[model samples]
Target: MLDIRPIGRSMLNKVPEVTLVFWLIKIMSTTVGETGADYLAVHVGLGTSVTGLLMITLLAAVLAIQLRMDRYVPWVYWLTVVLVSIVGTQITDALTDKLEISLYVSTAAFAIALAATFAIWFSVERTLSIHSIVTQRRELFYWAAILFTFALGTAAGDLATEALGLGFNVGVVAFTALIAAIAAAYALGANAVLTFWLAYILTRPLGASFGDLLSQAREYGGLGFGTIYTSLAFLTVIVALVAWLSFEADAGGKPEASPGA
Candidate 1:
């Protein structure tokens, strides 16, 4: 287990504490990512290509700001995450939709990419723990892993639903159960870092499945809430959560740093 402590009064960690709120916001951000990308691409008439470019540009700008920050800033960090989620979805969409790549191919490719990233990161840093993401290099690895997880999750979710005919709600239940099992294992002394990453990866697909369940048409297995409303509603909640975190930070409440880097 990681030791919850303030690393220093002067130097705060780069990532937020892994709390319930962190997971909540993460799931919500991913949901918004799926629907937001679709909203801009389809509803706004931007198309996938143009939306991809725009979102990538925005992600780059936000990531630059996040990298420049000295410590964890909730709004900036979550904004970068939201943008990354959107761009990640667009990346998989390009591969599968435009290039006509198979979901299985994309899923395998992304899994390999993520594994390579972890291998290189562990080789260079000697650790794959998120709690130790205090340097630029580790942060780079962290974000890269996050991007790949989103792409992989998008592909996996689509593979289960569209390819395997699992349907959106079923995918949600499946991923949710998997995550619960992981959590239970963690509680029973499984590797914390490994379990954390597994849960993180799983959350992407879980959230995406739920996003589709809400935004997709009833005929297509969703509840009939359009992409626009779903995206907006989730975005609103994300903003509120981030705002509260920012306020808490300003009030001298800092997230505890996990030990055992």
Candidate 2:
């Protein structure tokens, strides 16, 4: 009985705003990234390198699909995010566990990659706001930065837990505190772009730590529920949320312009 034409139009201009729902889902996805990667590498009997490679392949395919999309589809965009999160976690794990790379080096590499992506993105597109995703180059840079954030988050999380002996609980606390601080700055009228990006990067580690808390063994100071169960739970939530967002849109809907406008 309702008009249904607007849904397609809504997706063409920009992504959804940085709402609480967005942050909640983003954190959940990142948490799954940590646990899901570990499940494949450890429980599934695949070596870290193999698992990383497999995830990377899957990520590449998903990204290609995402790139070809003319506009944002809630399901398509979120699926890409979830896949990239898995791939990012694997990349950090491979570097640290398989190649014996130091966390510092991996973190630095990810930071550099993030910077380069931004540099190219801004140089080519002239704007990095999510509200202005009007071109392919901007989208490319967005995805690239997202990938690096997950990788950097993994490396930073591990470094805190392993190299510094901070433990998982502490790591979660630290990352959470940082995110809160960033949010406070944003509330105080700091640049939305800067605050949003800072919080975005930090959320990866915060979510990763929470995932470790939920899925790791009790001996390792976790609940030991295992990754499969955790991933399933999160995936269910993701599906439900995406479905709700899709159904709630007006006909010929347009995605709201993000606050970063």
Candidate 3:
């Protein structure tokens, strides 16, 4: 069994409480990740390589600030997440579009990488629960796992929707159904940690599909909203929610992290 110690959960925890709001931000961040990366690479003409470097540098700076903090600050934490989302998408895009690597190969490699991260994390800390990320080492492992999940999700999602010709609409429905099934399993007494990770991985692709559905041209089976409108709209909602969560935390209305079994 995985160890899930609840001892130092109060002020030491570095992550936010896993709740509906948390998932909402997560999904939308991923949507921004998908559309935002494309817009910068193609529309703004930075290309994936250059945009990746800038985003990676920005992510490193934000992560440094995040690490220096002792407790979870809503803006700082979510900013780190948003950066991670963009960087992750860039990483996968570089491999697929520039290097001409197959999505299947990239997807498999990221899966193995994520598994290895968890294996080492569990070995060193004896716990894989987000609730136990009260130390710098644990937080490092968590972030590594997160990066891989997003990269892997990008590859897998691209394989399904584009390579396999599922199109954006069907991809959205398929991934959403899969997430619903995972939720049902969790409700039926599945291990919380396992289900949490599963749902987390699935949401990346679900959000990507949804992003494409909104941002792509109508001829390509989308709503023709364009990347600018889609990204700006989602980012607006994300900002409002983060501010609200920050206020709630100030009011001592914090939510608890999810259970880890």
Report the poorest 10 consecutive residues by lDDT, candidate 3: 1-10
Better of 1 and 2 by TM-score: 1
Worst 10 residues of 1 by lDDT: 1-10
TM-score of each: 0.94, 0.91, 0.94
| Local accuracy of candidate 2 as per-residue lDDT tens digits, 1-261 | 322232223235436668888898899999988888888888898978888888888887777777666666777788889889999998888888778999999999998989888788788777777777655656767888899989998898888877898888998899999999988988889988878888888999899989988888899988888889988888899889888776765456646665663
Global local distance difference test of model 1 = 0.90
lDDT of 2 at 30: 96
lDDT, candidate 1, 194-248, per-residue tens: 9998898899889899999999999999999999999999999999999999999
Candidate 1 clashing pairs, residues 3+ apart or interchain: 3-259
- Cα error, residue 31 of model 2, in Å, equals 0.8
Screening candidate 3 with a backbone cut-off below 3 angstroms (N, C-alpha, C), the clashing residue pairs are none
- What does the lDDT read for residue 253 in candidate 2? 66
For model 3, what is the error of residue 129's alpha carbon versus the real structure, in angstroms, after optimal superposition? 0.7
Question: Which scores better on lDDT, 2 or 3?
Answer: 3
